[model samples]
Target: MMAGRGTSRRQLLKLTGAAAVASAMPFSAGSAVAGERRHGLSVFGDLKYSADFTHFDYANPDAPKGGKFIFRAPSWGFNQNIQTFNSFNSFILKGDAPPRMELCFDTLMVRALDEPDAMYGLLAESVEIEDDGSTYIFNLRPEARFHDGSKVTAQDVAFSLILLKAEGHPQVRLPLKELLDTEVLDEYRVAVRFTGNHTRQLPLLVAGLPIFSKRYYTAYDFKQSTLTPPLSSGGYKVGKHAVGRYVEYHKVSDYWAKDLPVLVGQSNFEVIRIEFFRESQIAFEAFKKGNITYHEEFSSKTWATEYNFPAVEDGRVILKEFPDDRPSGAQGWFFNTRLEKFSDPRVRRAIGYAFDFEWANKSLFYGLYKRSQSFFQNSVLMAEGQPPADELALLEPFRGRVPDEVFGEAYLQPVSDESGFDRTLLRQASQLLREAGYTRDGSILVGPDGQPLEFEFLSNSKGFERITLPYIKNLERLGIKANFRLVDPAQYQSRLNDFDFDVTSRRFAINPTLANNDRDLWVSHAGEVKGGNNLAGIKDPVVDALVDKALNAITREDMNVAARALDRVLRSGHYWVPQWYKPVHSVALWDMFGYSNEPPHYDFPVESLWWFDQDKAQKIGKGG
Candidate 1:
C-alpha cells in the first residue's frame, strides 16, 4: 500500500527498549520465560506511560462523544483513485478494500503516538519479554471481547498470528517471518518465541499485529476476497456498506475497552462514514456540496486554486494546517529494475536526471513542495553531506559493490534552472544513456540490440498526468519513447502486484523508529515476492545487509548510522526519480468536529480522536 503512515502496519510497531522481571512463569515445550512481566514493551528505553498511567498525554479524557463523523476516504495503497472496494478483508492481496479497515480490529498492543517507540497493552493487559528479547509473552485481558461478545483468548491471538503469517498480504506476512512459534499457555496468556536471528523490534512488532476473531474466519475464506464484514473487537464495526460507493462503521456502544487507558478519549464518533469517488475532483466537489464533511487536500494546485466555495467563505468550513514531525519518506517514479532496460544503474540515473523537480515545484505544484533528497527525508535518519565515520565504517565492507559516489558524498538529485527544460542536465542525461550501451539513431535511442528505448509511465491518478507530461517531454528529447498511461485502480493494482509496469509513482513512508520494514522494501528476498513493496525490484546484497544492521541496532545513534548508510546506497542506486513532499498536513473540515490541539507525531488519528460537536452540527445542518 505504498507504506504510508495510515497503511504500513510495521510503522505502528515502533520499538524502544525496556526491562522488567517476570514471576508465575509457565513453559510450554521449548518455551521458557527469562525475565519479569511488564505492563508495556519498548526496544531499548523505558516505557513512556507508567504502569499507573491513566491515559495518553495527548488524549482529552473528558472530551464529549457521540455524533456522526463523515469524511472523504483518504487514498489507500499506491493507486490513489480507488473508486470501489469489492472486499472487506484488507489483510489479503485480493481486492481494493475500503480505507481504515484496521479501525475495526484491536491489536494486542496499542502504540502511544506521542512517544517515538512505545506501545502499551490493549487487548493484552501486560507483556513480558525474555532478557535476550527472543521470547515475548502477552497476557490477554479476560474481559476483551469481539463485537459478537466472544471472548478474545490467548488461542485467538495464536491463531491470528498463524493465519496472518500464512495468508495475509505480503506487507502483513513478511514482517512475521521472524516469529518462530506462538504458544498458548492458558485462556489468557500466550508466548511468542522468535528465531535467534530476529531483530530487537520483533517482540513489539508481533505484539502490534491486529488480532482477528479465529471463530469468525472459520465461516469465511481467509484467502478469497469477500464483501462480508468480519467480526471486530475494536470500538467500531462495519455498519452499512455499498460495495463501491461507501462504507460506514458504527461505534460499538458496549465496546469492551472503552475505559481502557490506551483507548480513553478515542473512538468518539457514533458513526464514521467513508465515501469513495473515482476522481479527486469529484471528491472535492462532494466536499464543496457537503456530501463529504472533511477533506485532506493532496494536490497543491487544488489547495491553492480551489476552495473558494460559498461554505468556506461563510465560515462553515474550516481550513487548518497541522505540523507533521514524522519522516517524509521517499516518493518518486520508481523504475522496475527487473526489466533489462532498467538493469543498469546508469540507465536508471539517466532517467532520473530527466525529472525536473525545480520546474515542477514552481510550475505544477505552485511552489508548495520541497524536493525529496533521501529515503528518510525530513528526518534525523536521512544521510546528509558526506558519510560520517560511523556510516563509512558500515559502508566500507561493500565498497566496490556500491557506487563510488557513496564513499565521497551524499547522493543528490539533478537540479535545474526551473525552466522546465535544462540543456545542461539534458546533456548529462544523454551522456549517461550513451555510456550505458544506448546510442542515438536518427530520432530514436537504440539499445545494444538495435531496439528503440521506449517505456510506459503507468498511473491511476489523472492529476499525475500534468506532472508526467513535462517529464515525458524531456525523456522524448533524449530519444526515449515515454508515454503516460492512466488506467483504472483495479488494473493498476494488478499490474503493480505482478511487477508488470516499466515505471510508476510510489511512496515508502519511513517510520521514525525504523525496524525490519527496510527488508520488506529493499532486501533481495522481497524483490522475488510477487506483491512485495520492492516496487523497483531491488535485490542488492549490500542493501540487505544494511537493512539487517538497522533492524538489530541497539541504540538510536547506531540505528541512524545504519539507516543513513542504507539511504546512501539506495540513493546511489537511482531506483527512483525523486519527487516532492509538503511538511504540513493540508486539512479542511466542517466546524462540527472537536479534536485534541496536539496531533500525534507519527500518525494523524483523525477518526479515533475527533468527535462530533452537536451544537455546530445543528447550526451547519447535515450538508454543511
Candidate 2:
C-alpha cells in the first residue's frame, strides 16, 4: 500500500481556519502614501491576480496615465538568437513573451469579452472560419498600416508564413501545417485551405502572428532592422535600444490600433523600458534600489525571506498571488532519447523513481507547489483518474504501448502515500535502481559501466538553483552522480539548439483549445534538422499516428481521442521527471498600480485592460 501524503485530503480538512487565518495575517503593505487619493482608491480594496493572466481591467485602474514604466527582462537585455529574433515576426510562435514584455511587436487577436474562450480581431476586421473548419478567410481592417504608412496586405500575411517556416519557428507550419495552401484571394482577403478537417484553434494561431510590413523588410535589411527602430502596428514603437543594457518602447501618440476594441484597456503606459541584468541577485538588488517596478518570484525561499528588504518595510513593494488555470507545463530533467543511455525505456522509468518530489518540496519549497501528474494541469483532457470515456476513446488505438495503470490511475503515481516525503519511496527507488543494473553506496548509483551513473543537469535560471539543488542532493543519496551545470543565457541557447545536454529542465504550453500542440511537441515531422520541435527526439510510430489523428480531428470527440493517444505515448516513455504546479499566477509589483476585482478573462487580461494609477503611484515613489 502507498504511504505518501495526500495533499488533496489534507487541504479539505485544513480549509476550516483559512478565512480566520487570512484575517489574522499582518498587512504586508507597510504604509500608505499621504496625499489626495484620486477616487479615494483603497490599496487593498480589490485586486486581481494571476500566474499568466496579462489582461488589465479598466474600471478600477481608471484611464491609464501616460507615464514611463521600467522593468527588468531576460530577453531584452541579453543577446537574442535567430529564433528569438524571428519569433517576434513569427505568426504561430507569438506567445513567446518574456518576463519583461518584448518590445518589438504585438498580437492582433486579443481575447474577446463575450467569448472568453475565443479571440476577437485586433488588426483584422473579422476572421471567418467555415462551418467545416477546413477553410478560413481573413478580412483586414482598411487603413491599417505599419508605422511607415504602408498598408498591411494579404501578401504580407502570406509572406509572414513563408518566411517563418523557412526560418524554423517551432510553430512554423502550425494551423497551416495541415493546410494544403495559404492563398491571397484579394487585397484584403486571405484564404487558407486545409488538407483535412480544420481545427477551430487555427484562428487563434493566425491572430497571434505579428503583422509585419512586407515592403519595409524588402527595402531594409532583415538583420539591420532591429538595429534601427523597426516599424510596428502595435500600441508602442521602439524609441531606443542600447542592446544588452536597456530597450525602450514609446507609446505612439496616434497609434493605429488605439481605437480597436482589443486596445481599449491595455498598454496604457506612455513609455515602457526594460533593463537587462546578467544575474538575478543583481536584478533583485536593482529592484530594491527602485530601478525596476516589478519582479516575479520563482523560488520559495526568495518569496519568504528576500521580500523583507527595506522596500517592503517602506510600503513600496507588494507580494500578490492570483488564481491560475493555465497548464503548469513540465520543469524537470528532459531526457533526450536520441542519446543512447535514455533510449532504453527501463532506464527512464528508473530515473522517474529516483527523484523525490515530496521530500524536495517540503525541504526546499516551503510546501508551496503540488507535484504535477501530467502535461496538462488540472484540465480534464490532460489525463485524470480512470481515463474517462472521452480520454479512453483517444487512448484505445495505442492500447498496449501505454501503461494500463495510466488509464486507471494517475499518469504519475508515487511509491508511497504518506502526505509528504517517506523513506519507503527512497527504498523502492533504490530497488528500481538495482533493477536498472545499479547499486547505491551512500549517494551514488554505479552502473554496469563500472563507473557511477552520472549525468549533467543543465539549467538557465538562478531561482531554479534553490528549487532544484535539493533534488540533486536527493539524487546524490540514490548513488546517482548528478552534477548541476548552470550556464549563461547565450550558452544555454546554443546548447538547446545543438541538443547537447545530458538533461535539461524547461516547460511547454499551448493556447486554450489544445490544438496544434501535438505538432509542436511530439510529431516526428516537427523534428527536422533545420529547425524542428521534437526536443525530446521522439520518433515512435505510435506517437506519430496519434499526432496525425489529433491534427485531423474535427469534432471535440475526435480531438480528445487523439490527444489521449498522444498523452499515453508521452507518459509511457517517462521522458520527464515530474515537478510542481499552481493554478494561480504569482506576480509581484510596486503598489502603484490598481486593477479590477473581476478577471478580464479567465484571469488577468494582458492585451485588453489594466493601467497605472498615476496620482497614488507617484506619491508612493515620492520620497524614495
Q: Return the TM-score for each candidate structure.
A: 0.94, 0.80
Taken over the whole model, the C-alpha lDDT of each candidate is: 0.80, 0.55
Top lDDT: which candidate number?
1
**Residue 564 displacement in candidate 1 (angstroms):** 0.4
Worst-scoring 10-residue span by lDDT in model 2: 6-15
lDDT for 118 (candidate 2): 47
For candidate 1, write residues 495-592 as lDDT tens digits. Answer: 98899999998777777877665568888888888778888999887887788778776677888888999899999998888888888888899888
Which regions of candidate 1 fall more than 4 Å away from where they truly are? 1-6, 9-33, 75-81, 622-624
Where in model 2 is the C-alpha error above 4 Å? 1-62, 73-108, 113-117, 129-132, 173-175, 221-226, 413-423, 437-452, 528-532, 550-565, 601-608, 622-624
lDDT of 2 by residue, 1-624 (tens): 000111010000001132223322322222122221111111121223222333334333246657666665322111233112322222222222122223345444544432324455655665554424445567777777776667778888776655544442444443355445678989987775565433444445555556667777678654322344556666677676665667677787767777654455667777676667666667678777878776655556566667888778877787787665544454456787787667766677766765667666666666677877676556544655566676666566556766676566556647444333356766777777687777665555677666777788787665566656666666666767777898876677567756788888765543334555435566665554323445677777667666656544444456556566566567877877766766555556777666654543333442224566677577786322
